[model samples]
Target: MTDYVSTTPGLFPLPDWAKDDLSDLKGHQKHDLISGDEGEEITAAYEQARADVLEVQREADLDRVVEGQLRWDDMLAHPLAVHDAVETRGIVRYYDNNNFYREPVVTGDLEFDGDVAAELETVSELIDDDDDLQAVLPGPYSLFDLATDEHYGDDEEFLAAVGDFLAGELEAFPDHETLFLLEPSLVTDSPAEGLDELASEAIDTVAAATDADVVVQSYWGALEEKVHAHLLDADIDAVGYDFVSNQEDNLYNINEYGTADDISLGLVDGQNTLVEDPEAVRDRTDWVFDQLPVAEFDTVYLTTNTETFYLPYNKFEEKLAVLAEAASLAEVTPA
Candidate 1:
């Protein structure tokens, strides 16, 4: 076991490469890595990219290290994780510009694919050398939201199936500090009812199978009364609170969570290019720490939202350096 101190959360950049050897992973077919049409040319590049990120995280000495999401493999692997017997469809663009995904019409019997299991294990191996490295997975509620219903028919049944399947995946990663990340960009427009219960069941199902800590992340939702009420007794060690994606300057409704859990404070900008001010982040975190206990303050995490639209590969490293400074300061400052 590693001699790690579970005090003070730190910042992590979106898991893409900090310095692109050439350019963005766009234009390349999303499925190329898996099809083997691209072979090790694509696979080797991704592994190297992930290695670079691990080295950077090591140098920064972050409390948590993410295995860089280089191949788009597993970043949003839900499209391939479900059973093919289930129908499939795509989500509508909620905004004038939104990233669209094609997914299964999951109505019943959510099952895990061998691919997702192997992907998570691959990520684990990438960062396994780092003592603080934590593996990530798409949260059940968020996955259910993106998973559409075409032929399967019933929305509620689809959600129930997803819940069941996630329970199985959680069991697969039994011993490591796997941190599941739920991306509910749809929350910006339509956050569902009973999210807390939905999220709790998903986490509990996995917890029964594994010792890993489950973390619920809602990257873009505004934590209004209803959302807060739902999260009040969330059953997990960490609950992600996104000020960056929600565009809130501070943690406004965190107290709504009646339970004391770890708070992942998203401090960097994931959807845009404005590098944040280090001092500003420090002040905002101070305000949030005031709401929770001083001891618990150490449990607060720092990160950008799910993706890195903030900067290109080269510039992202510069931005990460600044956020690192803020996380360091947050440790000494009082709530």
Candidate 2:
């Protein structure tokens, strides 16, 4: 009903194929393609790895593919570039790599190395090649979640700075770079009140910065009205929802995501190891359509919640097949 993009569930790190400069490299590291390298061979090696990643993705049975976010370490890792513009203090350490069910709090100001802007051109090009592809940016709040608050007095100031930086990158993606995708997972991870405030600053900033339809995602599983109200009010083009693992306990508010102008319903379980039942997911989609206007369903999208898939490369294709089959059975249009 919504925009069509099948997933092997959660986003897997991108394959080399999606990257430009990496050449023919394959596997997970393929996702990290930077412009400059140690030398021609290193660059060449990166390129080789890059090309293989793309091939795997291209051959992948997915719709509205995400280029594997092969470039990102997870949304939290994105705003690290802010280190350049704002000098912050804090040693970043994860309590757990598998940590996601709850909010991952940052006790200090996270450093910034704003150098990531340099890769915008590559991101844009990849997204452009696949219009159905969704792009990602760190939510200002997530940056807040991770930033070490040293130079910045408090979270608010840190957010303000991150929001400003995010706005330019989001705007640049489609024009100076690629089509676009903005995933704000932080809102779903915390109380809607505080996260909403951060969402407002970040969303409005990017919304004003670009005309590309913004698709704000809440993969943190906080499927409550409060989590999404700000996005709706922000006038963002769409909001994404995930029912992959735990469907939010509250159903009344769930309708907002589907009924709201443009929403991507994440039925494919992107994070779990269990392969989803396409038919079952379709049934859920059916129920969703009852509450939302079937005619307006074009605004909806179907995908896995997030990309930090922990699986190794070999198993992705089969997982991808499951995702593709689910989408096909659900009868969602393929991208």
Candidate 3:
């Protein structure tokens, strides 16, 4: 039997109470106006929202629980944008989706500000056991791609700086179970030359800072050969493929190059509105394992292909149910 772990990439949709609290305080657009007593109320609302989301994950019997990132106003770039050296520029479309994030502009030397670390600490206190929580952050390469650099003139220098900053941030986080480095830009904007070595070096710098297991997850599409090889060689524990969006190419790459002993199979379709049947999902997982070489992987993480922010709250919960059901089914089947 395969050890089944279920988790999400962690930008959950804001619950109605959270939205209502923000609106009642001043309006979501004028978030800066929220302060004093109103600010405390808003904070309480976010806490309640986190508790609600965690309860859902716990009730679903998920192995890992995320903080839900309810306060990430600018999506993955929020943590970086909050840094003193970084400033927000014009809004840009986040990948191919309708969602947009304020593009971060690096105005001065990059440094690890405490935004993400502080959030991780707060989340740590909320959970009963540290091992049950998983911390999520945007990958350095993806951060560089999303931001406009003004301090570092050279691209290589800028990339290295971002990696160092991320390393510092990770080092600040309390001992937790896992760290997910989300890297959608790697697939959307594949590097031109020497990508394998460059990406591996950058990823290693950050992964080394944390004692917890590290998983670099790339979504949006399948990874190119050079990129895939680089990630496989990285110091991370596992690499997650966007099986829902690019199943054919991802499967082909897995068959051709093989994968790490630990693999994250994104079986749920987070982007689509349609929910998949649990039995069909089970069959697909079985099919993937059958195609792989013997002893290819020891653990399989059943998860969504992308963040749950794309779905409605109800649909998101429904999808979680599907993942939980599929994971239970996988546990009973022979590997």
Of 1 and 3, the candidate ahead on lDDT is: 3
Task: Encode model 2's per-residue lDDT on 248-301: one tens digit a residue.
Answer: 432345544444565566676555666666676667777665654343555445
Model 1 lDDT tens row, 1-335? 11112111212233444235313442364476233354445556656666676676566566666655544422354433335545545454422345444455555445665444555566567565534656566555566665565544565555556666666765665245546556454355344666555655654555455565555666665655565555545456666667665644225555433434466766666657677787887787766556544335325666665455334655566556656677777656634
Error of 2 at 18 (Å): 14
- Identify the runs in model 1 with alpha carbons over 4 angstroms from their true place: 1-38, 73-98, 106-109, 126-130, 150-153, 189-196, 207-209, 245-252, 256-259, 291-298
Estimate every model's Cα lDDT from 0 to 1: 0.54, 0.52, 0.82
lDDT against true structure, model 1? 0.54
The runs of at least 3 residues in candidate 2 whose Cα sits more than 4 Å from the true structure, single-residue gaps closed, are 1-3, 7-11, 14-46, 71-75, 81-120, 123-130, 174-195, 248-250, 256-259, 290-295, 329-335
Ranking by lDDT: 3, 1, 2
Clashing residue pairs in candidate 3 are none
Query: Each candidate: how many clashes?
Result: 4, 45, 0
TM-score of each: 0.75, 0.71, 0.94
Q: Which lDDT tens digits does candidate 3 get at residues 61-85?
A: 7888888888887888877777788
Error of 1 at 247 (Å): 7.2
